[model samples]
Target: MTETPETAETPFDRAAEFDRQVRTLVDRGYPSLAGVGPEAFAAAVAPLRDRATATTGPCDIDGGRIPFLLVVARGAAPIEETMPRTTLHRGRLPGFVDRSFEPGSLERFVVPEEIGLPDGDIYLLLDVERGEEFCGVVPGEAMKTVAERKRTPLTIEEGVALVTHFPEVLAKNKCFSLGGSRCGDRRVPALWISKRAPKLGWCWEGNPHTWLGMASAGGRSAG
Candidate 1:
């Protein structure tokens, strides 16, 4: 007996096909995310997914006034329409936005002063299928540092790999953690790690002994 490909498709197959189609479209120069691979692409897209999956309320900054810029794939109308407006503004991804935003459109929001805009236009990540993605809002002065940390058009795997390989680098230099998590049904854990000061002779101030212990344990585990 020969195994035959069934016409009936499972959700997994459909999802895989969707991923492949998205990958192909992205690789062919869709803009918002021009230079990333499948993994980084997936990671970048996660934020959008997270927004879509959110059941209680939309994600907000500055008490619902500031909009979270979302970089989504072109022609992704259903996904866009489904996303919570309170949490995100459906902006075209870097390469895709050139034609999307018109002058004086409310959809476009200036990068906040506190966040520090990059010398060039900032970009966001959109992962429609999985409901997970990230936002990259680096300031002008930090562009070089951000560039050193992650390559353009990153993939989900690459993003994770980067966070894993340079955990301390990101923690100390970036002033934030790699992933986000919800807490106690009300607040989100905005975990940020502090950079080590050159003259302080300590990593996290008041946590020197703990840091040393962890380091020693880590070394032992690695060995």
Candidate 2:
């Protein structure tokens, strides 16, 4: 007798898994930034900058909304960027720290330490070009729980389908591309899909991949 094939999971399933992982991390205190020394903190955040560079294609932080640089220097005082003059300062570090703790804040800032505190004269710097940057420290156990949750990786086909079916929603939500080409299709109206929706899975508080920003007017009209 022939055996039956197992059903493949859908994109929604994979996204749900990702959400579960995020929730688990949040629950277990996965994104806390504590106990990390200055050097380790800087080293830890290096990859996020690299990712931003790779995705944005070597563009200067000038005029950019998100921060690109994460520096852990030898002082509690903020390290200022010499060139731009407008954005370099100590007060900015809090914003970066806050991002890790607050839900809906991670998309705004990338926290490398995720769950550690800077030891001694360690200071953090974020490369903010256009918009502002922010961060915060969270409980360790909470972050661990978040990390423990499982994630379902997305296949290329599923990724494409998600973008195609929900172009506007994806673009508006900033959920489609983590670090790659900008979502290039015509901007669609922002569709807010709650993360707890039963159709998807009861996980995050909001759509995992959606942003609130509007598309450029110069881009193709969505009407």
Candidate 3:
């Protein structure tokens, strides 16, 4: 009998998944959106590709939780670039922001200093959780629970990256909130399946939604 590859336990092939992510970003023109050349952007993420292959186990899909090694483009890149590129429906449908929000308004949403994100133009988010367990809970309460767990809430850019790389994670009745980024106000940004497509929208902090959960991550790594 031959020894089995550990990836057999995973829902998808890790190497293939990683390749798809990279190819999607390159194909979707994410490099230019981030003000970088396509080849340079691909080179920058080459290390992550190497790292993914070297890792063992099931690639963090245990019990239906999808853990992502997110390659986030922030700082130099405007939110507008990443937001509209988030795709679903097998990359056919493009993402859109709620009509209520005007272009460039997302700049007000800032990551809290407490999150201690790594400094970089590009960075890595490790073991990102979609926070499915927090559905039906208000953002305020869910945030408290997240703090108790010692996990960091995900920013808008990070949330976009999750769906961009792994659109399958954004399932029906399983949308998530981006409480990690906020202005000095009551609004919380979120991504959900809206009008048969992926949407970047906002909800009140005090509100609860049975369909939406808070997204979070183990931490950030400097790329």
Ten-residue stretch with the least lDDT total in model 3 = 1-10
Model 2 scores what on Cα lDDT?
0.23
The CA lDDT at 212 in model 2 is 27
TM-score of 3: 0.85
Which regions of candidate 2 are displaced past 4 Å? 1-33, 46-53, 58-62, 65-223
Model 2 C-alpha lDDT per residue in residues 113-140, reported as the tens digit of each score: 3223234332222221211110011212
What's each prediction's TM-score? 0.19, 0.19, 0.85
Which one wins on lDDT? 3
Per-residue lDDT over 1-223 for candidate 3, one digit per residue giving the tens place of the 0 to 100 score = 0112236453445567666777877877878776788889878777676555544334443222444555665675566777678777465677887876666778788888788677666666766788888899999899989989888888988888887776777888888999999888999999999766789898899999999999887777763
By summed lDDT, the worst window of 10 consecutive residues in model 2 runs over 214-223
lDDT of 3: 0.75
Candidate 1 stretches greater than 4 Å from native: 1-12, 30-39, 43-102, 106-223
lDDT of 1 at 55: 22
Query: Which candidate achieves the best TM-score against the true structure?
Result: 3
Model 1 lDDT tens row, 66-169: 11123332223211221211111122221111122234331222222323212221132321111111223322222233334442222212122122212222
Candidate 2 TM-score over all chains jointly: 0.19
Q: After superposition, how far is residue 72 of candidate 1 from its true place, in Å?
A: 1.9
Error of 2 at 26 (Å): 23
Scored against the true structure, residue 74 in model 2 reaches a CA lDDT of 15
